[model samples]
Target: MFNDEPGDNETFLYKLERESEVQKLIAHLKRSKKTYVRRRAATMLGNIAEISDPNERRQAVKALVSAIKTDEDDSVRAAAIDALYQRGEDAFDYLVAEIAEMGGSEATERTATTLLTEWLSADHLEFRMVAATALGERGATAAVPDLVRALTDPAPRVRTRAAQACGRLSDPRVVPPLSERLSDGRQQVREAAANALGAIGTDRALAELVPVTQADEEGLRLIAVDELGQFGSVKPVVVLVDALDDDSTTVQRAAMLSLLELLTTASTEELELICGTVVDELARADIQATVPALLDIAADGTRRRYRQTAIWLLSRITGDRYRSEVIDCLLPAIDKPDEETAQLAEAVLPELRSPELEKRLRVYLSRERGSEEARSRAQAVLDEICDGSSGELVTTGVDYTYVDSPADYTNQHSSRD
Candidate 1:
């Protein structure tokens, strides 16, 4: 028997005396046969928990906790959790403990995830953060929408937790919202978004992270590059290649390492195709800046075909800018146990023919410290340059038409199938 007066805005504690009204609500919450009645009782107890009377607040909390533990209806249990949540810190602690305890059962786990999803909108920041964390830990895919919305919470910590939760869920649906967070004013939120985009590891998700690779923040760029390594896609690999020229040497190193990590996963054919696309798209100056990374790949690359592609890219892109360094990388490969690497180096060397390259090869040949195989390779490449037959060979299989400008190249390629 509860009061049903219309337009009565007085607090529940004052409208109905503490002992009588509270006892009735608790009885209905625990023993009511009707589901709606129990739901309403649970809600009232939550409102009552906000009252200043300590004894009444504890009684309300105890009733809600009982409803959570014993209520047969999911809605009733959810209502009880929401009610207990309003009881402040002590009840919130009890609520968390009860959810953890209930988590052992599949049905209760669903109920807990649903309730936590609703808590994402709670006025209290702690509730939002804890709910996000719990949903992520539970791997609640159903909570993704709420988590995405929470990505824009006024509090940076809430946004960070929500981004992390979205990542843990690994749902593609969160990709766009996470992308928006990449530019969040807060660095931690941006980093979390980048990390989440990487964790999702979908093409769309990985694509969202590309812009972040150019972020002004070095740490953010480092995170973007590192996460891109987890995915073995052409886009991320190409992005990593470009990152090789980053102003920050630390980023440059990370880009190189991520490129190597990608090699371990991406197929040889994929790397070769991406390498060709990279060569076609990158401006001459940008290509030149990548020499160090390309050399690193040429030296420590895992697959023979990829290493050869790296060498080919080095030849095509370097032109004459970093010829000395390119020669240094190639000469060592020529002496390695892998014959394909040796042959690729030897083939691409003649294409790199220049007075400078010729002089380097001659100097290399004169040095007794060089490996015999390396010296022999150098001799052959040097003879090609001197005999005036160096530039005749098309070592790189891709046909090249020189464009006056990068814009011309882009327009030509864009028009092609």
Candidate 2:
């Protein structure tokens, strides 16, 4: 009984029938010398303290409350606090009531407040981290203000958890304080802030995220790119498209991914304009995620540039579904009797599954008769459309078309629509 046999007490707790073993585990916890044994016993006691039946659980919770406040060891105390949550709202409500009652009784009453204070202020990082995490999980919105202040805590980890806790509250008011942390000196803290803002995900949050795209550091920029993608608005499309040219692959890829997300709703014209920036990369076929997105924009040809962009976008698509479109665009361009589009089409045709290039060389003799510059470009595009594949491919850097990058690859750009 003293040993608590790893699962014995827990087994009883799971069944909600450990009145005897619960007492034994509690006593052993008070006497155990090894920290691990005491901690384990404390956890079991906490678990046992929970009864599925409300009336019974009230009594069980009282004993656990006593354990949390009076445990000789810090670990035991922390474990008790954790287990308290499992007892459902009864345990916590009881705990809060106890704290209020203690305030009225003895001024020296070491209540739940006392325990909470100690855990948050303790020198041990894990204790504070766990306490913050548990509070966040509980999602006590009442604690949002306190969590906000903790954002400035000297320990980055604590502050990180605080941001996380605020995020869990999912309250808009937390946006300001949380946004402040985006420029946090610690990368870890910045990442935490990014996650929080992304999770909260309000327009206010997205607006705050916009400037971070140009943050001096690439890591922060990537974080901004990643977080922005969460909202999938074209508002950041220009921001992300600009990033496509970033010197760092990490930043570029992040931007690409963001754009891909935005493309789900972005207009074809918006996508067309975006083509030039992304098509070349698509053609490289290296970043498989951005391939479909480039193709989607390419297919929307309000402007020849978009088609041009599509042609370039086509070079990147190599999937089995992509074979036909790539072949059709290049095939017509080959003999469109125009050199440039013909050359461009030929460059990407191997991307298709037609007879060898030699076999299809003369296939487009009709369309190639005129408009060398025009026909060549048109035929090249036709080839891509003919060989287009269909699949939902992964992409990045998605933003709204009308809001950002209003350069208008087509004759006119529409910001309102």
Candidate 3:
């Protein structure tokens, strides 16, 4: 029934001084019959909160809180809530108090849960998002149905918050819907849904997540593979192993990491089973793509066992196929402060003995730029390879025979060597 030009209020509000403007916007926010006018006034009040005047800021905040309590239109109320949020942490307390007051002993006497549930159906997107988040935080089981419906909200953030809230609730009923969101167009939304499914952690939730690793979208497959690790069950090991061959390098890396996570908690039988599957998969995988990921895991200082596994995988996968690349990857590990890691790198170097590897090692030793300890390690490796003691290589659980001429070794020593 009310009509006004959109720019009319904005122009008039801009002409007023700061103090008068705050008061004028408050009047428009409280009395404007036009929905857009009230919405704009509420938005302007929030903007005014940034001013240096504490009294003016207080008045603007009070007006916004009043508008939220009395506004008939959901859009107006949503604008007020968003504006309060923009005012920063201090204004946020008022917003919380307003929500809490809804259930206070007044004529309406609406319970806080009932009001939040009702707001989930509000016309504005912010209202639905805040309502969904609050319901989940409160553990309002009765609001689960509404929160589930919110998972399909038109706004991606609303859907994301709803998904997160559903996760906090950890209700099995929300699992199917959360699973559906794993295919949501937005990456954040898809990730939220995957997280929610993981939080539920039911057998059914696990079942839903396992198949998503094979989803056509690499993003979905990545999320599923990552989430599968949190289950701490060996059931996803084979799927994760198979994922090592995924066409996407990122997904393949995620699969490898998930396998490592599973290894941390697997029983002896499970550990052997997983290790065997991984070894078999590595044999079939295009492991060249995984070199970077393996190098990172090996370099990580947090987990010794995983680091050992990474080094072993590198040896088995690269073999002699990627001589130069393997040398580059392992060289830095040679002087690592960790004795076991340094030893592991030194041990694997001989297994990779080839004319090309020896040449690269000699070049590394010749460089004046490398660390002294690393240079020393390289010198020893060069010595072992040239000494022909590398003839019976055994560290990597793999064997190779190298019969390079003594002449090849004689002049290969660098100035430092």
Candidate 4:
């Protein structure tokens, strides 16, 4: 089927399939324009492996078999297994053929390790990674030693891929090596470790990772928290809640967001406790990552209600002085432009305003990049300053006292809402 837009052979094959022209598609797929196109065509054919035309099926299968050996993309070629899933006895032949073609050193060892070792010596990083992944996925535990060795590959991508492939096999023996990698200097490597540990999912893996939540570096701890959240349960929740008291606001915020995500599955009481620290759980959990505010909260946040609860808890745990500091600490939120900060006064039951702290009087009327939200906030503060003292123009701090009864901060603070 000729089309207006010229594309690689895969696009033509897809077009032909839509037209229910399977027989002709199979023939053209064999002599593709390029190796990449040939592989994609094979993948689509595998998707429709049950095509009624026997001759067409044979031709598609032939193309797939050729791809298994010749095509460069191991991932696309790997689809053969899925294609053979229901084919039963016939599929068995394809599987055995792949294994035989890959495994050259007969009686002593299986898999493509011998060939792969030879390939690796020649700096074929892509093939080495692909072979390691395929071997591991194929349940060739014998490849674990080779896969682990790939962790030291000069190419970080290869090492990263190898770490992940090792996780897929989930062999106990790889745990020690993977554990050692828990503190890999590379960010990707460290993240990959958390992934491998998650895959391992052993009691040891859980124990090792729980402590990672408290790691001093924000990045590592974030990854650890993220991985732990994957194992979602009240225990991880409790651990995260405890982290809310950590010195780093970043850790506290991750704990809150993860805690919020946990709310999707947590009991109402737990969420209510979280509300005590951050009144804006939903705001903090925004996945759009649209603006810096979202990213800022996603990093480390002091959700107003959550902060209040933390203060209350601190007062109970430590004392009144720390509680005052917690309240004072809220200055950061009050001066910011966010819904979470806006509703905090009512939620926390404490009415405090930044009178001398430049008040952002203007509201963002609309939520867009160029909106006057920031300017409006600035104007509100400036207007208040001007109204309080007309004779002299003051530019420093804006007067933030309630227009009516400043003491009743909740009603005053909530007037806009």
Candidate 4, residues 59-154, lDDT tens digits: the string is: 656666665566554544554433443344465355444643564456434435565544333344544545554555556677688778877778
lDDT of each: 0.74, 0.59, 0.76, 0.52
User: Residue 102 in candidate 3 has what lDDT?
Assistant: 55
* lDDT per residue as tens, model 1, 1-417: 233332333344344434447777777778867776777777777675346667877777887877766777666776777676565667856665555454667887888787788778877665676688677777889888889889999989789989988998998889989999988999999999998888888878988878889999998999888878767756776677778788998898777666656655677768766555556644434654577777876777665655776687778878566787887788667777787778788888877776666656655665543578778887888778778454333343444444436996797788895
lDDT by residue (241-298, candidate 2, tens digit) is 6676676777876676565555443467666554444444444434344544455544
lDDT of 3 by residue, 1-417 (tens): 335457666676655435547777888888888887888888877776356778878888898888877898777888898888788767856666556445545434437888888888887877886787777766778889999999889999789889988998998889889888987988889878887887787767877889888888787788888878765655787788788778898898888887777665667767777666666766776666566677778777887777877886677667555656777767778878787878788888877776666666656776543678778888788778777444232344343232245654554543238
**Model 1 bad stretches (over 4 Å):** 1-105, 111-124, 225-246, 252-273, 286-288, 296-310, 337-347, 353-417
What lDDT, from 0 to 1, does candidate 1 have? 0.74
Q: Sort the predicted structures by TM-score, highest score first.
A: 3, 1, 2, 4
Runs of candidate 2 with Cα error greater than 4 angstroms are 1-30, 33-70, 75-125, 265-417
Candidate with better lDDT, 1 vs 3: 3
Candidate 3: residue 389 lDDT (0-100): 48
- lDDT, candidate 2, equals 0.59
- TM-scores of the models, in the given order? 0.55, 0.47, 0.66, 0.38
C-alpha lDDT of residue 77 in model 2: 64
